[model samples]
Target: MPDNSRYSAHIGYLFNELPLESRIAAARAAGFSAIEHPAPYAVPAADMAALLREAGLPYVQFGLRSGDASRGEKGIAIFPDRRDEFRANLAEGLDYAEAVGVRMLHAMAGVLPAAEWRPEHRACYLENLGLAAEEAGKRGIRIIVEAMSPGAVPDYFLPTAASAREAIAEAGHANLGLLLDVFHTVAAGDDPVQAIHDSGETIAHVHIADHPGRHEPGSGRIDFAAVRSALDAIGYAGFIGCEYVPAGVTADGLGWLPRRA
Candidate 1:
């Protein structure tokens, strides 16, 4: 049965082969009230909203695309040169968030340029983050910067919860929070529970995938029970995203979790 009143599982791009409406409907069929993954921008907001409402699902939070801005490539937020472009993309992303009535924004700060390892690169990232904070604050959107594993996202400015925490701290803003993913946490060598505890006030959106291969919870080595306890202890109340690569059908792989209805 499906638990009508419980935690929502965030489906990812792994299930994109299905039409967006079907995907949202299937998530509802499987008993989750929300969805996540790459920004669902291709589908018009009104249309997306209609499907979600019909299925009784909430359009909780989604990603910010990171690609080329110059020559059509458009990311690497916080770099000195990309600041203006990044802000434009941020504003654009915020507009999508508003359309869905989302309270939090899941952001990929793009990769830091190769020079970010240099002395001057540090200042550039901090200054740019300040602007991002200001912009997100204006829209009442909580922007969480994600940190991926080195193997996953090599040059990105935020590559671990620790680094994300430090950078957000340095930027010194309340709206800026950490978008922690368990798979990346394991890849980045972080204690998943401790990372959330460490982030304290800044841990916003969470993406949950088990490790070894980004499979659905319980399909990989992560102890979801422990992780769930950690979130419960912290009084965290946000979508625990299932941003995993499907081993089979996405729902079949994740249906192991307990459901109420």
Candidate 2:
């Protein structure tokens, strides 16, 4: 086990071979004080909440309903014609967050064809985000937008933390912020340190995976030490979400987790 005070297990990537309850137990065993997931809509919210309480873990964050990935739809927020779909998903996500005591909701900007980046799309995105932020704010929850790397998700509307910041500003909601994924920043050819420094307090959450392989932090070219230093410089006191794909057993791949005690 390690001193995982600033770490949270993204169960979608860690111990994903197990069910939710088993994943929670594994995260606790591995010394994580909090947990997050991609989607938990399959299980009842009460059941998920009970599992977290039993494991003594707080729910840090979770993503809103991105449309079916198999159909090439990453999310609905920015799709001009999917306003109703986005609203439905937003309601569901907010309900789930309230039920599970999640404090942050990552509202993924949908992937669109390059030709379809029209004014309507942008307007729809900001409008939907504004509404989502207001609704989440009422419950003391924050709504965060993450930038997906274009290399991994081609034509993703949001492709860099800089762009996310601009969008958050346009949305004009105090509860809106950014979720800076270091892997995506590298993939977008942006310096992670600079991104963190520039994003500053707008970064309410973070996700980490190495650039070259999207694996454990130390398994690739990313200089996590430098990244940590930049985060420290910015006075970031949030969890560093472990969202990398494990090379083998998830636990065996956690060599980068600090063993403070």
Candidate 3:
């Protein structure tokens, strides 16, 4: 079994009952070793860092802004025209991460019309990733890219672990790695176990959510035990992020959490 200590609560998904500033304490109370957030821009970096310090928890990972959500832009990395925007977002994320003690940053590859996904888009993504990795590396930070499930985000640039792996290889940066989310791997019709094995050391971080509904573990068909076994097999010592929606109350659904000794 995976170590209970190797779990972090994604406050952006869990602990929705409380305000953002309060979720850090809630996660600590729930026994999570650490905490991560998808979007922490709303909270000033110094304030967020103070909360983590007060809660005695490390801020593990966080996502860069996915462009203008109001405009339905899931990401900006894949657009040659938005390279400036992508870099600006990365700089902002890096500043926040440095302040909050986060060592891993997730960079989302934005969507594009199916027919418009040209070689230039791929080239642009590689270039942007290389730049991100190099810049983040200077701070001893790692850059991660996740493959979103098509069912959840249509036209998402990287739609499978294989694709994200390919991009990582193409980027060829030691500081760049894959952010493997089991929900996306399974929902994309790929074996999560196989993905874990394939990603191995290239996986800088992980996210967990049940398939079919993206709900908390045990609410869907995913074999979380098997998932744990695979993670162990790969020697993934990093925290596994609880990035799922609660079927009911977030704390109530935490029965799935392995008991900590």
Candidate 4:
């Protein structure tokens, strides 16, 4: 647990594995005041709202499901073949975002192209975002895209800050923005903090964790204190999400953070 009050946890991959309500309970017990994850479309929206209220956690953020990369499916907005599906997903996401008080909706490149970056691929991605931005604007949710771990997702699109910046620029929509991930930055061999600073103006949300293990902030090879310092320097006022696995009990490894914060 981060002792700092400034920290929040993205009940990331874990939320999908547990009973949603139990996950919410775990988040609050771990000292997280806010929680973000994919909406439980499979679980009823009313049940999710009840869980959020009962757990006393007020925050939620999530991206719509992107299919497996192994299947060669690119994000609908990014690949021509998937455009219709992508737009439909966005509509569903917007409805849930509204019902659940989700403030951020990451336009995560759910799946990647089979090859490396392409001008054609980039065009599709930007075009898709342009349409989705209109939907996001109406719902009051920002559609920020995220970069995944480079090696973990090499063929996937949107792995670097530069590419995402370009895509957003071409899209030219205010509602379209960037989501920064520290674990992916380290995986890409870029200074996550510096990237954040350079992309600060365009940044909408930040995902933080230590690497090479993607563990909680203090337990990995990456210097999280430095990352936190860089974020502070950049005047980044967005939530710093604890998106890592715990070495022990999630609360045991994290309880110190809330006290210190």
Candidate 5:
């Protein structure tokens, strides 16, 4: 097992084949101190809270409800016409974060309409994120902005770590920060270590998936040891979320987990 203290099971990907409650138990059994989910809005807050308590696991992170995935809306944060919808989602996200005792909330940036950047869209995103950051600050939750890869989420507005950092800065809120996913960094043809070095303290959370396949850590070309070294170099203390699809059985792919010496 990985050192439960340093790692979090992203149940959304790890035990995705199982039901929610079962996944919670599976994380506990696998020795994870915490777990994250993509969205838990379908589950009642009380029920989700009870399950986490039962497993002695802390809820580390959860994402805001991006608009319809089937309809190709990756997020509403950057959609100028969806300002009201984004506000409603933010309120729901804050409430859910409080109920689940989670400290971080990922605010996904929606896909670009023309597969290119738009000034108005960036403006709308900053406004929406600033509002969410204030609300999140009140609830002791940090708002995370993640950079999506073009291949996985084509036309995504924030497609690079630098862009994410810029958005967070322009939002001008203490609670706004970056969700640095190493897989996305490498997939974008950038060095994951340099992204880590650049992100530094603004990194509120980290996600792990190997490049070329988006599979478990050891199943692809990423050198997680170097990633670990960079994280330590930057004094990052947040949970390292194992957010990868397994090539086979999930449990069978956990050998790359960092066990404490």
Candidate 6:
């Protein structure tokens, strides 16, 4: 039997067939121990919290509002001119997190046009990250940054584990950590096992998806057993979020998941 205790169902990706509120009960019925979503603002926090409580599952992690996703803005944290917007988004995310008992938030580094990229962008990102860490720390929350693959998220500021590590070091906040996603790590040409080893205790959370297709685990080239081993080696005890698109029906694609018996 596969260990289900540490797996979190990312409802944002999985259960797309159902509405957000219904996804909670689906995750519980599907045997997930926890659930996460990138944007649940549409569902009131109190209602979401009540759903979680009724389902007996914890809401683990969610991303800060990426500024106007419809407008192609992945995030605003890396733009010097958008400081106010970033902080407002952070405050809103924190409020929702507190309402739902979540302690981790993914702070996305916004993208920039290739021609407009400048050193000031990095400086701005570091500054915003520091502020986010400080504010989140006040509420006993830890802020995590993940490197999204350029192929998937064009012009993303932080696109590799190395870049994310450099930013974390420069930011120098105890509450700041890394959210290691195996799919992005591999897509960026870095070895996921090595990333897990190098990140060590700085890894606050983990995401899993097979590369090449970004589908369910066994549908692609990633060796999830090795991923699990590396995570174990690093003493990572947090939830491993399933953040992949299903090849078919969500439940049918779950053959890769081990049964509880």
Error of 1 at 24 (Å): 1.0
lDDT of 6 by residue, 22-90 (tens): 999998888889999999999999999999999999999998999888878888888888899899999
Each model's TM-score, in the order given? 0.88, 0.96, 0.97, 0.89, 0.95, 0.97
Task: Give me candidate 6's TM-score against the actual structure.
Answer: 0.97
Q: Which lDDT values do the candidates have, in the order given?
A: 0.71, 0.89, 0.90, 0.72, 0.87, 0.90
Which is superior by TM-score, 1 or 5? 5
Alpha-carbon error at 118 in model 2, in Å?
Answer: 0.4
lDDT of 2: 0.89
Per-model C-alpha RMSD: 3.0, 1.6, 1.1, 2.6, 1.7, 1.2
Residue-level lDDT for 100 in candidate 3: 89
Residue 149, model 3, lDDT: 84
Question: Is 4 or 6 the stronger prediction by TM-score?
Answer: 6
Overall local distance difference test of candidate 4? 0.72
Clashes per model (N, Cα, C within 3 A): 9, 0, 0, 13, 0, 0
Q: lDDT tens digits, residues 1-261, model 2? A: 123798999999899878767899899888777899978899899999999889988989998999997888778898777888888998999999999999999888888877868998889999999999999999989998999899988999998889999999988889998999999999999999999999999999889999798998888899888998988888888988888899999888866676536
User: Looking at candidate 2, what is the lDDT of residue 227?
Assistant: 91
Model 3 agreement with the true structure over 1-261: per-residue lDDT tens digits: 366698899998899999999999999888788999989999999999889889999999988889888877888898898988888999999999999899999988998877888999899999999999999999989999999888888889999999999999999999998899999999899999999999999998999999889998888999989999998898888999989988888889888787767
lDDT string for model 1 (1-261, tens) is 122344455555545567766888877776666777565777877887787778887776775656654543224565567666667777877888788777676655655556636655667767767776788789887777778788666666677889888888888877888887778998888889888777766778778777888776676778877777787778777776667778886666656755544
Error of 4 at 250 (Å): 1.9
Worst 10-residue stretch by lDDT in candidate 3? 1-10
Where model 1 places Cα greater than 4 Å from the true spot, the runs are 1-6, 69-75, 112-116
Q: What would you estimate as the lDDT of candidate 1?
A: 0.71
